[model samples]
Target: MTKAMLLLKFAGLEFSEDRGGYHKAPKGKLPFIDDEGLMVADSTSSVFT
Candidate 1:
């Protein structure tokens, strides 16, 4: 997941390396995102959204 974060960072996007699950999220999960003005969960769903 860190690699994925790095990739986004290289792309000039501000992403957070918080793959340690969130209270609003499920357990044993993590999220990568580009939190500039809004939170963008960098996942497969992103393609569809």
Candidate 2:
């Protein structure tokens, strides 16, 4: 999770830490992106997108 945060920070993207909200993410995972309305799950997928 820390690594994801750091990468996002390096990318200069603004995001909020959703504490205790893993259940709301796709695949019930952490470090997902709710970009405009698109959902990208996990760091690898996000980077590619």
Best by lDDT: 2
lDDT of each: 0.51, 0.79
Question: lDDT at 10 for candidate 1?
Answer: 68
> Candidate 2: where is the Cα deviation over 4 Å?
none
Best by TM-score: 2
RMSD of 1: 4.1
Q: What digit string (tens of lDDT, one per residue) describes model 1 on residues 1-49?
A: 5555656666786644554557534332456444444544555544345
Model 2 agreement with the true structure over 1-49: per-residue lDDT tens digits: 6777888899898878878778778878776778878888877777777
Question: How many clashing residue pairs appear in each of the predictions shown?
Answer: 0, 0
Report the number of backbone clashes for model 1: 0
Residue pairs in collision within model 1: none
> What are the models' TM-scores?
0.37, 0.71
